[model samples]
Target: MKTPATPPNEAERLLSLRQSGLLEFDNRQPYDRLTRLAKRLFNVSVAMVNLIDERTQIAKSVDGAVPAVLPRSVSFCGHTILQPEPLVVNDARDDSRFVDNPLVAHENGVRFYAGIPLRLPDGAVVGSFCVVDQTPRDFSAQDLAALSDLAALAEDEFAASCAATTDELTGLINRRGFNQFAAFALSGARRRAEPLTLAWMDLDRFKQINDRFGHSEGDEALKAMANLLRSAFRETDLLVRYGGDEFAVLFADTDEQGAWIAMQYLTEQVAKFNQTGSHPWTLTFSWGICEFDHHHGDLEQWLKEADRKMFSMKQKNSAAR
Candidate 1:
């Protein structure tokens, strides 16, 4: 019943959701099968695997009459993703949050609802695995545990598909996955006339860490840096492990000024991270930003520009050091 507000990492969470390649994908069997099982096991009229996008909750799989897309404002799944645990409403009429909600007040009353957040390995809650019924009913502890297990299966499917596109070392999207999803993401940005910024970055002195500390330490540095980048950027940004010691982020709906602000934020975050003493060696990165240009009409060309700028910054940093 509570109006679900955006989480702190909304941008990153949404980006994680988009990178899954689930929204545009038609209803697939693994997802559909899970929902079917959830519906029957819970004895609910409807079961769904839903992903909450910017403005809408998209039903990736559904077992009942629920629409493919529902407004986020009206979505119980929206509230469901706010927490790490399952959200259960035994009787919507009893809860103030849903007593007047159209889904509850309308004839097709949603009297009993239970949803567990579908979390990505990166700790992003992209949506919910949920069941709904028109008739009021109480769910036992066993029921919640069962729902959680089904949600885990749903997460397993996400992890499997994500693995194909993810870098094994850092859990960031790999180059191949980036190429696959970036085109679709760019197309959406163009359609909406939104500004897109690409930040191409390389770690400063990454090789030095490997030489001094060992390969194990080098891997740790990569992961540490990836975690920093994840926390610093928006969920909407496409953060990728382009290769060893190099990473790339595509910021959507952000202009040059906005991109600059984001970069500044990262600088502050790194400084704070260094103070934490989490790593034996300090990490620093040089980056270049390329704003999307309609004239280029080529992703490769745009990335090349970013690469050029990044090299320039790296050279400058080396000279300063």
Candidate 2:
């Protein structure tokens, strides 16, 4: 079997794919009203404001349309990523690109489409402001111009999705958001024949401090650790609390050798915190760094493998002392 061709600009693509801005969009009446206006103004049967990411095309604001996500490759909005101005397909059955698309063959009876490009803050084309129709419809230059205006407004929200994963605690990514980031990072590392590390850190025996000093003190310690973690790592890296004494960081674009060096730096600061704090003991951590591989299976399995290695190293350290 032939392997798939490697995707171009893998890192940039991963970042682009991790975007979920429109996925979180509130399907309110105003959003519906806007798309409905677009459809009626353009004299079309359907309209949708589609946010196109790496794998899926999400209908954030849709009016007079189906309640679903269309596959990214098949969606007419995806073509806007490749173009400068509005993409108008007067008849999908006649267009070479749309002829084989399933949506053209059956679903939605999409005979015509017009999509204007939308961008994120980083200036990446991430979605489109498009109107679709069951019958072939010609768009006047006037309709095209109006959609362009609306496309710019949608781009504003698209830009906000870039920072959607940030954690308020330390301005780091939260647990829920980091999983997608981490996976994409690993995929890039694997594709480029580079190295990436899944680094897991847990404060050694942290429960004793919370038990002795009280939960308020525990909260303080967590905040302190958050600050330290922020300072110790680069802004591009992802740090997430795995909840209760453990935190995980994905060292994107890093190798095993480099990750190990960083791990030592983390351990030293955690030790210093343990030593200087007024509690009976300072906080220390056990960490495991795993360089990524395509064969590590899914995200859960890869993390488990890293955790096992970390636990093994921790046990060995304890035994040595």
Candidate 3:
């Protein structure tokens, strides 16, 4: 039997896998649901989300009673991650690549196998979402499309995983986390017919602060901003430190006017903080709010609208000064 060839970016791929923290991930509910759906939809005997590490294939989630770990040399998933497309073997016994592989040569082995590589946003192939059957079967174009969709969802779960989602500095959700939670919030808003407002915030003269006080002080300013956001916004709201000095808040079940009122409170809190001389520099910011339209656009589009408005406000404030 031939061993799966190592990926060209094997070192980088392994680093991404380890950093993702999926190997030691304990929460398997989301993955289990996806695998279960795949098994039911495809009528497969085994459905699993498998993470391929350096020497072993770890099943993060499985719907069948299969071993949680397997030698990478003999793993079908090890080959799946090598390409950009789904790997489908109608009969592994008939394919030279997997013909002698123990998984197929054994009793009640994997006869039909279909797997789509699960990729991190950074284009690293860390694992695969696969469905296995004891009997050989044909996989149609429609089957491949369905599997791809499920695999995309699985990838989202990985991006939203704790290891990947948080901004290490401020303990706020990063952009990746925003994508996952924002999608869920939008879905919930649509279903419940509730209003959802998004706010974009930028720290005014933030670069000057870094230039004058050093990066350490800039970090402190960011932490202060994050803390202020936490104190001002409700716990239900989604707060994110969206890169450098940019921040965002998704106000659930709130309208544009309500969000504006909350911003007013945050402004007051900022003024109080400055008056207290809590830090070396005074805090100031520019912000804009947008109410999401359920029928109109996506999260990125919505974010752009708010960002455009915030930029406009920033420019106007600068001109006034």
- In each prediction, how many residue pairs overlap at the backbone (N, C-alpha, C within less than 3 A)? 5, 2, 0
Clashing pairs in 2: 274-282, 274-283
Q: Which candidate is the best by TM-score?
A: 1
Model 2, span 91-171: residue lDDT tens: 988888777777778866789989987766766666678888898868888878898877776665555554556554445
Report the CA-based lDDT of candidate 3 relative to the real structure: 0.90
Candidate numbers sorted by lDDT from highest down: 3, 1, 2
TM-score of each: 0.55, 0.50, 0.53
Q: What are the runs in model 3 whose C-alpha is more than 4 Å off?
A: 1-163
User: What's model 3's lDDT at 155?
Assistant: 92
Q: Candidate 2: lDDT over CA atoms?
A: 0.71
lDDT scores of the candidates, listed in order: 0.87, 0.71, 0.90
Q: Which runs in model 1 stand beyond 4 Å of their true positions?
A: 166-176, 179-321
Q: Which candidate gets the maximum lDDT versus the true structure?
A: 3
